[model samples]
Target: MAVESYKKIETYKASDVKTKVVDTDVLIIGGGMSGCGAAYEAAYWAKAANKKVVLVEKAAIERSGAVAHGLSAINCYLGLSGRSQFTNNKPITLEEFARYVTLDMMGVSREDLVVDYARNVDDSVHLFEKWGLPIWKDENGKYVREGRWQIMINGESYKPIVAEAAKKAIGEENIYERVFITHLLLDKDDKNKVAGAVGFSVRDPIFYVFKAKAVIIATGGATGLFRPKSTGEGMGRIWYAVFNTGSGYSMAIEAGAHTTQMEHRFIPTRFKDGYGPVGAWFLLFKSRATNAYGKDYTENVAAIEKYKPYANASPVPTPLRNHQMIEEIVQGRGPIYMRTEEALQKLSAGDPKNAKKLLEDAWEDFLDMTIDQALLWAATNTEPDKAPS
Candidate 1:
């Protein structure tokens, strides 16, 4: 199992490569969830106005971007059907949701943007349900709430479903898959206006020069900027999509777009080794993250008080939680563990059959969202209910 060696590959310059030019009313740069969403919206207006829109994706939209592997839960739903206990059993209001986001970002969030997302997020979720994604509902016909705003789903085909809708709306002929956009083209007369974009085919030597009145850059965030824990074959094993290398941000900044919060980055504490999401374990399975000494260090009020209001906020901010864990590791109480065994036993309520079922559910959490984690478990014979991860 030797790691692949890096070697020189074929290289091409702007003058050497063949270029193809396309003209359209609107051009979309990325084909992630944001890109697909933009395509869907742009298509509606384009059809109404009889304007042409073109969408460019580095990979196929159906299984591209961060959602390619699927998600076990939709983490941003604010439906009235199922109220969260964290909000005191009341429906989470737009203002409250805005506040939560702001607090989460240490009061650095734009209230307007949060409000806009809060208002329309439910419609998107409803649309997802309508688009053949199975959303889990309780016996009471209410969506099953996982956390304050999350709802469970059999979302293994989430991106594909969304991509299908986008493809239908935008028309498949307009989308250019496997074309890697390199930069945004500025208008010749007005430097502030983006005229189009330039990219190249990943599968071929042909370069693309897309000319449009409007350009939407929906490329996701950056990953691998900082060195990861494992730098060999596991270099790609990160919480965020490895393909998202801040190309969108880089293109925008290069095209004179002002950037804010450049330093603000989210470092999620995922399951070790495989980098699996711990949301379901924490919220749904009622699991606790403990230090080497089996202490729930997040409850250390003294350390949390330093973070002030954010720490006091319901479901303490992600950064603050990471801070607590880091402190534990820094102070020689290293090797923190997810108390999966304890969580499963409590969830099963001492029933052997229920425990077995709960164990299967635990595995499904990883299999549905992160197959790597399930494979890791299999490779190591890691019975989650028998040992902490």
Candidate 2:
């Protein structure tokens, strides 16, 4: 199909074009979480200074980027006081969070960046909540804990909520939907500064040339660079948004931005056929991941210093944990199962849906979170049956 399309495009010329121009003070490329956040933040400041802010996304901002399906967990947050706390309680300190992150990464993290993120992460989550995101709470009216640094949330409409907020801040007219940015434009006076960008509409052949004083590139990561475990019928069925092809990274590299950590890539361990996250079950309901030998491998390695900090925490580092799990599999211990028996039993004693009732109320959230796998479960008539995964 690609070959046929290329053959037809052999006679196509760059000169056959229609042009549209947009002038703004700040232009944001990519309508993902970061991009939308930047747009709204810029608009917040721009409103006081009477400046224009524009955002262009390859896809619709309402359903684009990594969190398009929404996230059940806010992984990096201050314990419970920051935003979720309704009283005048002090939140976790920036230094404490930074130290925790450094320890988690085995002393190989940027302290300054971690501190900054820790300081602001809760506010971001709170903003989403203000815009109509629902955080799960317990019987005592406290926010439910997914892990030490994570919280459960009803975030199926996360993208749309943020997108709507960004639209309100910057004005809906300033947003360009379905615009595939090909490259960045450098300023004539100083090459160090970005002038604007050029792109084409994904739905049409119209060409676009945007001119702005400053540009923010916030497209998410690339996934197709490495071969996925699920191949053949389910080639692009792994975690991370498949639509996120790392175009922003490529554009930044081409624009001569100093890049780091290119060699460090995380290998996520997912379910066998469906490829959905198994960590959530463990984190949310105290589920255990056992191997073919019916032993929890993570418990055996809890004494290791590198994993000690997260020995009690759910959702440990994927790269390291996955390594340990793989080693166990290679050493004749395969077929790991994410067992949620205790939670299932408690739920089944009264609730027929079991712990899945949390999902049943927000079924769209579940479907969006696990697009293919949830569908696969439905198609196969699979039930939780005390062992959800």
Put down candidate 2 lDDT per residue, 1-389, tens digits, no spaces.
45444333333356766799999999999998998999889998999999999999999999999888777667776754534433234455667677666655655677887776777777887788788988887776676666666777767787889999999999999999999998899899998888999999876668999999988998888886777656697787777788988889888888777787665455577777767665466655556678887888776564344655554443455556776777677777877776655555654567665546644632343464766667766777765543445
Clashing pairs in 2: none
TM-score, one value per model: 0.92, 0.85
Model 2 stretches with alpha carbons more than 4 Å out? 1-13, 79-91, 261-264, 299-317, 346-365
TM-score of 2: 0.85
Highest-scoring model, TM-score: 1
How well is each residue in 291-327 modelled by candidate 1, as lDDT tens digits?
Answer: 8898998887777797886789877888888888878
Point to the candidate with the largest lDDT. Answer: 1
CA-only RMSD, every prediction:
3.0, 4.6
Which residues of candidate 1, in runs, are more than 4 Å off? 1-16, 80-88
For candidate 2, which ten residues in a row score worst on lDDT? 80-89
Candidate 2 yields a Cα-based lDDT of 0.74
